[model samples]
Target: MDRLTNPIRPYAWGSTTAIPALLGVEPTGEPQAEMWMGAHPGAPSRVDRGAGEVPLSEVIAADPEGELGAAAVAKFGPALPFLFKILAAGAPLSLQVHPDLARAKEGFEDEERRGVPIDAGHRNYKDPNHKPELICALTHFDGLCGFRPPLEAADLLEGLGVDSLKPYVDLLRAHPVDAALREVLTAVLTADRAEMARTVADAAAAAERLGGPYAPYAGLVHHFPGDPGVIAAMLLNHVRLQPGEAMFLGAGVPHAYLDGLGVEIMANSDNVLRCGLTPKHVDVPELLEVVVFEPGEPAILRPEDEGEEVYETPIDEFRLSRYVLAPGAAPHSLPDTAPQILLCTAGRPRAGELTLAPGESVFVPAGETAVLSGAGTVFRATVVV
Candidate 1:
């Protein structure tokens, strides 16, 4: 097996310290957040194929079906179709949605036919597949996912005592999900500046009065004062996952990665439609068109009690499972399937003879028998047939 070198993605929302600390490097004061370990074209991991730093794409091309397995090649075509990440969000990410597979394919092909550069900053769709993602929390991860039941939103809004927000609270109490969401979001996104500013000020005061851990929500109000997302956040379900917990996001789910480190796996697509809480492109009408507006709680995924420790999500592109190794525990054998990526989230562990520390990961190709011993917890990412 060739020792592969992973790629680090420098994104503005990334934590300056989290990933750098794991890599034993001094912080460059830049936000170095995601360390990608698979062969997704955006930031394909480098493989030392001989003496040069060749992209993993070249290595897989030499023997497409053999190296990546027939199942992967047939599904993804000539390259690794999944992207694996160690994502650390220092601040909240923009509320965004990904288009469905049909839309993604059409958009990508149309852009390509028009001769648009794939890496152009303005490029939205990069591949033909919809991006379905699963984030397994390595720390306490908080996020806004989907829409909250209208009654709960009404209760929160009513308690806040903001007169301008009362219309929205009442709308949620009375109207159906879509109409209520459309009306409320439309009002917030296109409200009169002075009226909305006063309402936000009152809401922040109210959130502070009814405070606990949620008191911090007011700080977010302070951080992006008058930003519509702060108000929009009230309308969505607030979910937090402890370490070892997981959440799945399919196409059209309005969600944001709030904070903390996580091992994330997603279908290789890179399309994103932003709603708010960012300085990046905001295609509000496009986002409004694609979002699933049913008012409900976020679905927290639990692993099925199979003989194997498996954390199953609601997608087909990738499946993430974790094995927490205790001191002196016997070596655990992993699921033998198509190509898999194994990562150590904590402690020191040995995969064959190579010792790995926290954040160190290795790619286990198909048909390989990988034995784990020594120490640390490991999360395995593989494709589900």
Candidate 2:
């Protein structure tokens, strides 16, 4: 087992205190967005072995099959397949969607053939991998996921009483699910920027005035008033997750985290296509092709309360589960078939011989015997195979 030293990303939308409070450290007064704990190359966690600290990416590359196990190496290539994170959102994230595997491969190859720089602002596909994610809320996490029914969305918009938005409400009520959602979203994104800003302001005013279900959207408009994403966000279903509940975000699903903290895990990829609520380049044509034009309620997941609580997802790259340890409980014999990252979110949990405090973690290589005991909340991240 290797003691992992992870990297914290300071994104502008990040909370100032949430991560610090978890790490038991003083705040630097800047936003601490995410504490990443896997080998994503962009920000790989470091592990201190006998030879001193080394990047986890390099450590894996040096001996992939030995570290990741033969099954993982054969299935997901010579890599750690998943990236685990502690995400803290203070404001709203970009209205974004991810490409499916086939689309991701096509987009990446095309961009590479065109000689686009990897770090270019307009670059859509970061790598040729699909990012299917699941976020388990540590707090009351607020977010927008998928799409609400067209008629329901129409009713919500119609209630706003904005003249400019009447066209959308009419469109929603006029068409079927796919066309209604697609056309309304297209109209919102392709609208004149100045006109859309005015519409967003009016909508914000109305959302504030009618503060029951509309209260969440009013906050998005508050953060990004001029952003057309505020209007785009209205097309999605608003969801709030209490502690212990989880939400899964699959390919081509339009979503955004509005506020609060969570434990997020996804395939080891960085490909993101934006729809709105950001200064970053949004490829509307690409995003349109990528988004799934379906209307339904978002799945709010609750963990299956087995001996070790498990949050089940449909993908093979990542599997996330948690254990809320009580005083004087028997140690858990964690599965040693795959590589694992054990994160302590509260109290002191023993991982092998090391005692972990909140925000501390360890990387156990495949076949390593790890017995987790002591009182704490520990989240386990491993591969399905």
Candidate 3:
């Protein structure tokens, strides 16, 4: 096991103090958006060996079979299949969707063939793998995920009584859920800029007048005034998750984190096709192609208790589980087969010879066994071998 030092991404929408408070460090005053703990090439965590520090990526590259286990190396090649992150959102993130593996590979190869620079702002695919993620709330977390049922959205729009939204309402009421959602989203994304701005203003006003479920739309307008994403936000489900609660976002699902902090784990890829609510590139055609327009309730994941609370998902790339150790509790054995990233979120926990405080993490190599004890809450991220 090696203590890991990770970089914090300072995105504009990040909170100034949320990550600092969690790590028990003084605020840097700069926005700290995400603390990435993995061997992803973008920001690989540093592992402190006895003699010196080394990039985890380099370490894995030196001996893929020993570091990543033979099975993982054979299945996913010589790289970590999952990326773990501590995501803090003081403001909203971009409205985005991730492609499936097939689409991702096609987009990445196409862009490469077109001679687009890998670091270009307009480059959509950063990798050739799909990203399916799960975020477990560490604080009160709010987000927009997937699309709500068309009938429900229609009722909300009808209650707003905005003349501009009447067309959407009529479409929703007249068509089936999938067709209604597809058409409404298409219209919102492709609408004329001036006309969309007018519609947003009117919708914001209407949201203010009718203050029940429509209130969040007004808030969205405030955050991104005149942005077409404000109108797009009206189509998705608004989710608020308490601590310990989680949401799984699958491939082709559109989502954006609205506020608060969470422990997020996903496939190690960055192939995002954004639609709106960001200063970054927005490829409307690609986004439309990647997004799943089916309407339904967001799947709020609740961990299953079995000594540890397991947060299950469909993918085999990552498996996240949480352990809460009370004072005087017996030590628990860490998984001995797979490479794991153990993160201490609360209190001080001792694992083998290392002690971890809040926001501290360790990288446990495959074939290693360690016992965890003392009082704290720890989350374990490992591949599902």
Best by lDDT: 2
Quote model 1's TM-score.
Answer: 0.90
Clash pairs detected, candidate 1? none
- Kindly list the per-residue Cα lDDT of model 3 for residues 1-385, writing each as its tens digit: 9999998999988999999999988998999999999998989999977768889999999998888888878878888899999999998988889999999999999999999999999999988899999999999999999998999888887787778889889898898778888888888889998998898899898888888777656777777777888878888899999999999999889889989999999999988888788767888888888889898899888876856899989998999999999999989998777889999999999878899999999998888887899999999999987
Model 3 lDDT, full chain set: 0.89
Q: Pick the winner on lDDT between candidates 1 and 3.
A: 3
lDDT per residue as tens, model 2, 1-385: 9999999999999999999998999999999999999998999999988899999999999999999999999999999999999999999999999999999999999999999999999999989999999999999999999999999899999899999999999999999899999999999999999999999999999999999988889988777877889988888899999999999999999999999999999999999999999999999999999999998889888876855898889999999999999989999999999999999998998997999999999999998988999999999999988
Clashing pairs in 2: none
Error of 1 at 35 (Å): 1.4
Worst 10 residues of 3 by lDDT: 214-223
- Number of clashing pairs per prediction, in order: 0, 0, 0
Best by TM-score: 2
Over 4 Å off in model 2, which ranges?
none
The lDDT of each candidate is 0.78, 0.93, 0.89
Q: How accurate is candidate 2 locally (lDDT)?
A: 0.93
* Pairs that clash in candidate 3: none
Q: How much does candidate 2 score in TM-score? A: 0.99
